[model samples]
Target chain A: MAHKSAGRSALARVLAVLETFDQDNSALTVSRISKRSGLPVPTVYRIVAELLEMGLLERGSDRRLHVGVRLWEIASRAPRALGLREAAMPFMEDLHAATRQHTQLYVLEGCDALVIERLSTRSAVTNVTQVGDRQPLHATTGGLVLLAHASLHMQDSFLSAPMRAYTPNTPTDPAELRRILANIRTRGYVVCDGYITPDALGVGTPVYSPSGDVIAALSVVVPRDGAQPMTHVRALRLSSRGITDALGKPQVRHGPQNIRLFPFVNNEQL
Target chain B: MAHKSAGRSALARVLAVLETFDQDNSALTVSRISKRSGLPVPTVYRIVAELLEMGLLERGSDRRLHVGVRLWEIASRAPRALGLREAAMPFMEDLHAATRQHTQLYVLEGCDALVIERLSTRSAVTNVTQVGDRQPLHATTGGLVLLAHASLHMQDSFLSAPMRAYTPNTPTDPAELRRILANIRTRGYVVCDGYITPDALGVGTPVYSPSGDVIAALSVVVPRDGAQPMTHVRALRLSSRGITDALGKPQVRHGPQNIRLFPFVNNEQL
Candidate 1:
């Protein structure tokens, strides 16, 4: 028998404290954390104390709290993020060195594309994407590639809603987006010009797992006027395939199998 | 009034569950988690359900649970880690490109040297260190550098203990360690040969904040019998200075001061 009306388990409240932290508010006073998480001040204080003792949260000289290095260490050991990033790094490095632009690796999390890792050159074009940042499925090249290979249910849900346009060139109409997704599936890659910003062009391709399922997307963002975008796309595809091959290796296969497959119909190409 | 003993608080139990997953065990079943955390099976089940719903953890097809991407995203945005990481990346990249070896940035946490970031070449010498791994204070070059410039109480407490000898060359005698620390302070860099591992050499220098307090250590590890370790020491010193200059920039300064000066006498060379 489960109690449905506990109003939120102690676990949820603890997670709530962690969730209160974000990019803009990395450090917070206990009162602020309480306000942000909607946890009672005393409860927040007690939870914060326990977290501090456990090394999940740390306090700085300012008396404000921040995420602890121990938490990062534990999370880094997680097979999903670090495992994929390790397998993808050498390839990502090659792509970054060759293009001398922004190279990113993303995995689909629910309805959003979560950027797991990114490398950018000093003179690269500015983009809103950052490691650990989320982008809409219809507005980013990596997101589009992932969305193109995503399940039919996900596609229907994404297409049913009004898509937010980041720039004038972004395909907001569900019909046009549906066509683009079809083309991505057929062409094995997706390239969008000024989709997120007028000055940037994004190109991406899918990465596959051993079972030939599209597991992630690798993309490069370059200035719209920069060198031919096709070159980056070709490099990304080659690198993505290399990563897939790496994933197929037996050593990495022993890790978690939570690799979510993009629900594309034809899995042969991947 | 505080609850005398609210079953260790649901938050504490949840943290214990997360804490049980580390580098050695990244994925576990509910039974394993219960056993490792000493929590009852029924309680573990209920909390894991809430955690899965909140995307704090995910269950793989094999029915094993692992840390979730959502947790990583939330932790990644913390300014202490990401902000420092962002500021240090360019310099770290430069050091890595130039040396083609293992380059690391670390800060003092508790009694260990906590690596905040690291970059390594595939062919570089084998190092047990990872991005968030912690190494003993006296046995690591980075730790030694941080210790040399740490508060008198910290330095004494660390040196006073019987240091764990990781390798035959590791400095264990407190008097000898103090002498070596004095040399590091005078030379502005440290060359630790066969300290952490017999096959490796670690070189390190202190990174200072705007107020000229040591906040971190920058180091490089290379093969013991390879080229002169002094070269890496020079590079580390230069990179440390570069990071200190970056930290001194007015645009980056925010919040309360975290600078704490070392209690030892300032040697002019450093």
Candidate 2:
């Protein structure tokens, strides 16, 4: 739901109008946007007109409004998204080719793992994750890897909240998840068996920035039946190292003491 | 340069500040933004502050400003961008694997071809185009194919302009380019030898939308020496057809009469 407040700033209104369009509601009529955005019809009209003129929005053939390519062109330059994506792409391709499964790149955003890029095969195991889709931190292997390297405060708060169990194997209990996270940090990789889907198993490893901080997670999803998690983990580590090298940073062998509880505390606001 | 006219609306000002960021200038200081945007320091500061609060802009560790992940997250939902990309990615990956070269997707933006998606191997032939980079319509295979399907008015205006010749083989003559475009439409593909750069050959084909209009171009670039352009063309046509089917559009074999000069007139403004 949009932040429905009186006297919201013009910028806030525009953001709300833009936010009204998402994966499920990619296109909407003016009235639908006004209803979803909680902005008045006239206000929505003015904002839409301005946005359309600026090429931030486009009118579809059916007269519904969709986000414009111009906006995407501008936003594609964001270093936080495409910059990281560019660095990880080649390695991800290699992993995808080797595994013939779903290879994904993720970053922590709020309490969710935001998938930025995913390479999927036509016959790969079912993966609910799509690019730009967010999954709960406790329900996905990529999220667990990121959470393990997250700050203590974030982990504590996250573990304090009640999390949904996507499958019976999903780790939702705070104490058990804490142990699992600690294990992931020690192993430097995670193998999640049917945490998100009963038929899928995911192997995840951290991708470090030039500053030696965990900036993202690289993972591959394979069929849980007859899955060899360690084999996937080995492949993941190799690709993760490749991504780290591509980022102009050499892979640092982290001893137990070098593993910080808050490697990305400054990188993301928890 | 950003529009710096006085009394611009708040939307325009916000856009101006965002526009100041490009691939070349991803990170900027407040003063640099002010100078590039041509806005007063106080105004720029206020706008920047609001944007920072909304998470549209982020401060890097170096204290310089960068485009934030939140902005990219929202913009990633643009159907005009990721939607098309999602449909084209599998086919693009297949093309990349088969050719071990640069596989790209382009759409006509203004008088240029805007690359929305590109897949490249680490040791592939040199490709000047990057994702999000714009190439002159007459200088690259993707651009040429898109230009061929453009409306008559756009083609006329584009040919009337002084075009840049990236290489000696680049087509700069209006009459020659017109003939090339006609050949492309008739053959449903084009082979560009050393057009954008020496020692590279690009083969491009049109990707049709569900409406039967040319929505984008799919292309692959390989080394020129002993390159088989027909083989690449066949691969590109297959991938383009796959993308068209993925878009829920059954591929229609276009006769010369069915190929309208203004097929995309309603699709794009120019």
Candidate 3:
């Protein structure tokens, strides 16, 4: 369907080569990319060569290929990711400082919660959430907050799907999950004890927009051992409100702020 | 030269479309993309269709096209940007808190210092630096530190080029810049007063890797009004050391921490 519409398998081929490099497979050999992408070796080689020239891919001294910095520079302008991140950063900093844990801001993408921003310290617990990473809607506290506030159609579709059980405590049963979601929408926050991992407790609340729509989720993952999850719930709710207030402001810039380091001709272009 | 090499100029054409979206032109119409990229409208349609299918480009509610979340997700794997960002975030947070100003982490990309991470509050003085944004080597304090600690070959090549004079005070004379670079290397930090923007002062220091290579720079931009550039120097130097120490650590996870919100088979895959 994708091929017939665009009529350019070249784009597909390029995307296939790119799909080979994920978190674990960041650095890959040409042969490995060929095998993983299921593209012929020669095609992969040719595509890699083109990507290298375009600065979309780079080769390391170890002869491993990885995604290029140029690609990141372009993608950094993504409104949904970088835009939300720029808005939430200050509130997130306050939340992180107060909680001293793995604090994160997430946006609903597809059937998962895609983390747009995250703040962690060296001595923090084993909360592994990272920016640009996604978590299933049923397993994360932030995900549940998003799910609860999502449109009824989205909520129904998500609940009906067979959800993955992240941990034994992960509520996969649709009926049980529905009850949890409903509770979250009412309380405006949710605390999950050992939902994703046993050692961490997640507290999450929704970040709203000027139109009163739930635009994002704010949360903290703290160690479960002697941890007061309610304490973080208060902070998350407060920070989420701060983020909403910041977003509601008209003067707040979106995406990357246009910095004018050089006043030669045009500042916008640079 | 690029057109001749790709054989399939489709990659170059696709990149041209992607390049049409930037800080100012974050959202563009199909025709705008065609005009900006100088590609035929039909050719743009074909490329855009393919890009939309691959989730590399998204169409906004306003019917404008933008770089998509998927692109950001893929590019987030970039080691030079995201990896360094991961290691420096905590130290950056501490620096921001201590100074209560715009704290930033930058890496030398080409002849510019590319901002990898930044921390700021709403009331902080006008800090125009943004994540994934670039500041010219001669204009920014961070850029000067990177240039100072850079390899001799790089330094020589950069100095020989005819550089832009950002402001009247911007050091355009290569000999003057050479002296500044030398001073930075000797003093361990730099403070640029009214170099980039007239209202801001930037203080910077180098972050070193375990192998003693200068991997990144740490800096802050505070208002020039009663701005004690020397006061921020200590904070910046200490944070630079903290970032260097963090990077020097063997276990500092590259990119975003490998968040395991879902344990169904492979959390890394999700």
Candidate 4:
């Protein structure tokens, strides 16, 4: 039962209404929703009424609309987000505790890196990454790691598209990025200094699935000053391996005592 | 915009299809979904096609359908879930680290407690409370704290319902529960020893919003043996206060350094 008369499906129009609510513009009026979704006021009102009835959208005490807890409950069943985040949380916690910086986990979604979870120390750095936010696959450390391991077709398309340099140090040259991706494959990690932000340094490593595919990237962002790259790289590689192991053994869940952690490798000394 | 042709609205049908996939049945085939959601096969197929196109549902390599990451991204913008979570994570982390047990946050929704987030130590204690799962208001520690602070009408309805005793210790009598709930309000915390599980004890405290309404509960589940209920209560109250402060000062954000933690009350001595 698509909405053929409306020129778009009913689900599409409803999604348009939902899409208008984001991190910044979470609460909005009906007119604002109509403006944002490009739908008529009556259409927006009808959709909003149905959504409110279904508990997908809630009107706040201020009378502005917000995404409801019911929608969050429904979306929490997403295996990709819930499973990976659960598997990676302990390792991420360890990394965050040790470094007192930002520990982020990202998955490759449609040529962009989608942050699934992040644990940040309040005063650690100036990184702007937030959970559920997407960043370009070429300019961020996690993005580069994920893109390097992504399908060759995706890599080709990404390289062909015009890229933005968030900072002067961001490598925009496709040839140079290809070399960096190749090096990341060889080194098992990547260290990007001032790639996304001028004052931040991020080290990224790939996390694997049970079938040996790189499912996600685990990264740590620290301030540029006193940024010991190898130390962060070693910690990230170690944690990513832990996540990979956890992902492979779904039966052996959550107990730190059950999983055997890998010994620390002093790659710099080596 | 509503799906008037079908018996149920289009959005309702879509929600029904989405509801078929929960934590246990995350991956399913169309036939199974049709069986579970009770929709016609062709109707389910058409809806699934639309959902797949919109990236709300995904087909895995095994040919089973699963909830997509795009849906999770949309749900993550849910202010009720995300804002509370971001405000509570650090405090939960602190509690989890100090106690090495299950630290959970819950909000009262429709006479039940909806677990929004939970931090568990692998071997701390056995807690069946997964994030997004619901528990009865009269049975769980977090539930009682939330129910106690909820509207008087909600409390009355919950008390009138036929309750099941999960264990011998679960409070089922309306009079007894009312007294316990009243005690909880007076004490500003709850200690449920063997209420749900005989081997576990839980302590819960209320978290306030900027407007000072009881928005959520911060709780810990620990092994009943040697369970210092007072110790757990103190930690929960402290963290609940921290969460309240964070919720109030939205601009101050994540720096633990900025928030002044309250001194331990030593309530036992008092």
Error of 3 at A189 (Å): 2.1
Candidate 2 global CA lDDT score: 0.82
lDDT of 3 by residue, B52-97 (tens): 8777887765677888778998888776667667767877888888
The best candidate in terms of lDDT: 2
A-chain TM-score in candidate 1?
A: 0.89
CA lDDT scores, all candidates in order: 0.75, 0.82, 0.77, 0.80
Which 10 successive residues of model 1 chain A have the least lDDT summed? A261-270
| Candidate 4, A109-185: lDDT as tens digits | 77688899999856778776778888888988889999888778888889999999888898999999999999998
Off by over 4 Å in 4: A1-5, A252-270, B1-6, B252-270
Off by over 4 Å in 2: A1-5, A249-266, B1-5, B249-266
**Alpha-carbon interface RMSD for all candidates, in angstroms:** 9.3, 11.7, 9.2, 10.3
Q: Is the docking of candidate 1 incorrect, acceptable, medium or high quality?
A: acceptable
Q: Could you give candidate 4's per-residue lDDT for residues B1-270 as a string of tens digits? A: 222326888888899999998766778899988888888888889999999888888877677888887899998877677767887888898898898889999876666788988887566677777787788889898899988887787788879989988889999999999999999999999999888878899999988765667878889999999989998888888898888777666444222123222111100100
Candidate 3: tens digits of C-alpha lDDT, residues A123-174: 8887657777788889898789888877788888888878877668889999
Docking class of 4: acceptable
Quick one: RMSD of model 3?
Answer: 6.7
Per-residue lDDT tens digits for candidate 2, residues B56-147, read: 88887778887877788888777657778888999999899998889999887667888989998778877776677788899898889999
